[model samples]
Target: MVDPMKQFWVTVAAVFVALLIFVALPVVFLTGAMVSAVTSPSASGPSGPVVIELDLRGGVTDQAPQNPFAMFSGSGLSVMGIVDVLDRAQDDDDVRALFVRLPEAGMSPAAADEIRQAISRFRRAGKPVIAHSQGMMQSGAVVSSYMVGAAADEFWLQGNAALQAAGLQTEEIFFARAFERYGVEPQFEQRYEFKNAVNPFLQSDYTAAHREATLGWMNSVYLSAVANAARDRDMDRTVLQQALEAGPAMGEAARERGLVDRLGQVEEAEQRALTRAGEGAETISFASYAARPDTRRHRGPVIAVIEAEGPIVTGTGGSASPFGDASTIYSDRTAEAIYDAIEDEDVKAIVFRVSSPGGSDVASEQILAAVRAAVAAGKPVVVSMGAYAASGGYWISSEASHIVAQPTTLTGSIGVFGGKFVLSEALARFGVDIRSLSVGGETANLFSPADEFSAADRAAFSGWMDQIYDGFIQRVSRGRELPIERVREIARGRVWTGTEALRLGLVDELGGFHEAVQRAKVLAEIDEDADVQLRRFPAQQGFWEQLGLAFGGGAEAARALITLGALANDPDVQAAVREVQTARARAEGSHVLADEPL
Candidate 1:
């Protein structure tokens, strides 16, 4: 009964309204949010006698995520962010004290060290830092948790809780025997005996060199942890070390042994902290405090902090999930960030924060090139190594103006190893067969899974590995000002704790991010006590840009979905995927990999 013209008009009106609601309005809102976030001065903190509550239940991140939403969420806990907050609060009279809850599971040793340094500085400013632990489990990073707790003015343990702040242990599973039984062969060549990254496939047990190298670093880390705790607790270093080695102790026993200062529940600890904070002092969660603007403002020389955390790879780096923390140090992205810092006139110095195991050789070279370029431009680049900076991690850091690492940080695996597993026989057992044909040189099918490496292939691959290894040692020698012979003496792919690395001239200083920043300031001729503006490299993206990437259509959307799914899988499965990817790289002729297997 309706007229056709009237119907057409109504349909057009509905379409236009839908567009306004779904597309046009969202675009406008995102644009507004981006502008506001970018331009607005940070909101000031509440005025009061404030006691900051730092909860370390979740592990700390190396750096804040690039996600624009994270800017508003205030969910990310990064080492530098926490340090900056604590440093700022040190001078704020309104901020009376810090009450910390140690993480249930262990965090990275380097991160714990950085936070501990901040707490120490805060206490030096005459503010109390109270730390409480519910329990220290025998698993995970209990040692790291205790390290942070030991820095506190008043360290407390829950009643009936066990103190498992004992030591560190790493478990390795060798697949050589299992592979043989399953009719699979792992053929690999390492640069030297100490380069044991591929040992799981090559030996059923640790070789003499492998065991020696592993124990050397592990013992150093353990000794350093004990010494640090002893100094903080005012106890004899030998006695503290002996007590921890005796075994786990109960709460009261821990207090008696001078391991912890008191035994109480978390609530009691919090109340005690508040009482010490002063009359009518209110508590503010660390995250909330971090979200608030810094009370003191300083316009000073700029220091760029460029963070690269995770595996180094070719091409671009991006968040594994738009809303998650996992990311990679893609060569192009990291190089661009370094270049950006170099180009910024206000950036007087560069602090390169690296936390990675290792990845592509080419990618590491790219990042290292950028570091060299920064020095060439007269900007000093000081590296602050996080938990582990081995293999490719060391590659990029080798040529820095200065390098700082926590005493427990693992570094200096200057060696190469690569090969592939011949899986034809294993596949036959499963009633599966893979066939392939190629027309080319003798080496055309060198990487075929159906065959193992021949003599010619092995020789060629070994020579390639030698080239990479030689290049790595040469870079280290030049940077460290050591003789090539000295470099070679220590270049057998052995991992060293930062404490030992300092003695060996592998790392310039044994400290954390705080020390690195201080060194950067010194190198740049800035006053020791002067405040510096820390400009983060690869600046966070705007809200509109992130929104577009999150919901964009086509191949990009599909790739994002796939990455999200993979990241959301079980941790074990993700680990398996990582191992498989490494093997695949080796099979694809990437025979010059510098990696460590901690």
Candidate 2:
């Protein structure tokens, strides 16, 4: 009696809708899951071989990406991002090799050294490292490229490509010569010889001693790089030096110099990748891992990753400052965080993630002291270092029960450096003078707006730094169980790779954040299978931090955007930014002794 055709059409429509719900949704998710797994894949292959390609694109920094959507969350950079790739690649049993995609990073001489040494570690792991350079390198990127080239089982570059392995050079442009011609008189105050950060404003030609020191440091870095390259690549130092002097070598020139292991195109390189990594190299970019999973069924002891980044500063009178995460580093907030963590019985242990280049000394002491309190309260503390933890950074970590570092993490650089700028003359030339009057003996000792630091001022500043340096030596000495003499001998503000640091006793172990946490658990005597949850402190963002994000962005957020968008995407811009940032940070003012050191 009913229309049979109409009934059949309705049934067909229902079946189609059901198929959409069941088949379509899964297909979409699976595609994303797979996409996130491989940046580019060909044909069907196993979901294995995760090689962290180091386009080492930007000027390197301690902090990097932090995604709320990420399954493994951290308030700061995916500090473990590099490790995530490394662990998966090695553990998969299917992954046969690691393809290190290094590019010109436009970094400072010292920065390059850090990256190069990091690559050496993967090679030593028994896994093959294949380094390929599609572009040219000069400063930091070159150092990383050469380092990987040396460390890798094989290093390749395009046949037509040029390698601009420019030698190191540091030239300071003085404004005094130009300022004087404009009838400008500059004024400033006391500091050390090394405080010549403001030299350009005061002098025309470089100070002989200052120039010597700078040159000496640069030369030291250069020789170290050259020697390491020669040894790693099986080339002679003389040969390497010649190649460096003659920048941008191509084809046979590169081969003859032994800078590259082979001359090959991207296709040949991939074929090599397949041969070494076997059939599993497809998932090299897509897989991810973290120490703990998000979903937990039961309540249990938690091991939290507390990041201590940036300059340590004293509390702004219990005020919640904008800088809270380990990246921005406001010491008062950090102290408060530590204070809360020690009291929280749920936190079984603490793995303090430290990556800083020193800040305020007072802050450093406060943070370290808080950590000591936590240890006293029965919670063991382990320090996990990232790219760097020098000066005041070392101060806090020195007190940890144990420390861990990636071979490339710059860990040492003990000792303190503080200085001020006397830009009065430079400004006056521009018809702008900074006038200041002060009361009390040497009240304006730091930034005397009147004139350059008299010899007496320099002596005073130097003496103060001496005392702080001595304290730093003793603290590290005691914490590391070494003699003060030995600490001082190696504490001349020289940076070291995490591997070097371990040998020097600057760190206790060579691993990433996971190792630190695992060690913390072992030290804390927690059962391996005990349920754990990360306990966050200060449990809220301070007003200023929120405001900063409202206006510009939080430090971490800005850095993420900067690295991903601006820094990574543009090489020239990255270099300019690094030069400006480093220069400005050095010239503006200093917490050398770390106003908030830790």
Candidate 3:
């Protein structure tokens, strides 16, 4: 008879091998499938003249994730992807024309401008682009939507749809009164008056400085939008502005007023585009065409495009919201990307795309340091400002070799504010007791929610804000080569449009991503007309790599490991395993345990 202990050990070994195979096979198969899915092209080019169809109802993003799975899953169309695909389509012989539908309301002003620029280039290449609008509803940035439609070679509006692209309007809500009624105190300090981000908490209405700054930027944006649309439609700016200012009009009235070229259903507009494309023409979704692999390889100097989109934060990973997913500029990751570009011999320049409303001061500083390092390493760093690059956003871009902004991009707001909402009084009324215990000095509890800032705390916080503001001014002065006093005049926590910012010597160029790339080319001594390979830095992680990261460590992994260890050590588990093993061995006519019945 075989030694029972030896047989038991062999049985356990066999079960362990079987368990490994059970778990490992599926993982291997799944990984292979994922790899194949990600590597394979989403669409292959068809043999015909294709009218690229783009539907903007899903809205546009600044950039899409580099992951192929995400790209093909309708993650959403991105502005840069559209621009790049259009640029390619210009040279594509089979691409006869573009048929695009504008979003119902609007997209980001800067994003719309970029798409318009791309369309303009495609049109210059002797291709027709037709844009259709269901309606220019009165919603977010209606004028921007009209600007895009106006850029197309042919603009179409749905019959019976209203042209509500009147102008831009803003509504502000102040929480001071509400907080006062609720017995909650909002204690805050700002470097100066124009920094009105905290004004909602401090005042019942817009202060003189706040109103002045708000209107200044708003007027500039309004004029720029009208001017752009007027130019696109080949109409007199004054006449178009007057007509739009008169009021909303029906589709026919809009056509008569020269805002749109035709009034028809979307289908009719699409048929017109196809008819214009000549016989045997076909239509392809814009996403499908964009997913086609590019056969052309650029053998020029590499320009690393680093995206720092969303609020500047001091850690890894992005944040999610009900509105949508917003990619945060994690300091460590962003800085690492900059450093990688600086060290890469093939990369001659860096185009840092900044789209943020600002966040942590330390995080912004970390990214700024990397930018400076890139410049010092002889790599030209050019900043391409996105929708809104305010406060910390501007901070990181302050020292770039060149700064480019869209005409309506919001920049500046070079100020700092800090404070908290004290809920002690409000909670007390609700019979909710909140106590604070700290061992440090008076200002140690500066951010304690239960206590409002004392006079000393306020003084201390104000001084800190002043220091941050001064640093911001100094950096701007040094970067822009402006006098400190001049920087001071433009600072004061005031936000400025790219147009006004350009006028005040704040931004280097008023343009979009394409222009920023051209500036980078010029600075890197590369031929301005030559195409350069744009390598995106902080390259997207592979699926398996990401998977490993998810399960590798942290609190979850620790808990899982502990639970697994405990399960393995439990006596009941061991006994159950032994019984199962003995039964399986007996069925196979092999001994497992001596005490088991034979």
Best-matching candidate per lDDT: 3
Candidate 3 positional error at 70, Å: 6.1
Q: Count the backbone clashes (under 3 Å) in each candidate.
A: 0, 21, 0
- lDDT tens string, model 3, 93-139? 99999998988786788888888889999999998989999887787
Candidate 1 minimal-lDDT segment of 10 residues = 34-43
Q: Report the lDDT tens digits of candidate 1 across residue range 307-330.
A: 988889998634345565565788
**Candidate 2 — which residues are off by over 4 angstroms?**
1-54, 58-60, 65-79, 93-97, 105-129, 164-248, 275-304, 311-327, 344-351, 378-387, 402-598
Sort all candidates by lDDT, best to worst: 3, 1, 2
| Candidate lDDT values, in order | 0.80, 0.61, 0.81
In model 1, which regions exceed 4 Å deviation?
Answer: 1-46, 67-75, 295-298, 318-324, 542-544, 550-598
Model 3 is weakest, by summed lDDT over 10 consecutive residues, at 28-37
Instruction: Predict model 3's lDDT versus the native.
Output: 0.81
Tens digit of lDDT per residue, candidate 2, span 327-434? Answer: 456677677788888887788788888878777778888888888888888888898886578777888888888888766566666766666555677677677877
What TM-score, over all chains together, does every model reach?
Answer: 0.83, 0.61, 0.84
Stretches off by above 4 angstroms in model 3 are: 1-42, 65-75, 318-324, 542-598
lDDT of 2: 0.61
lDDT of 2 at 220: 54
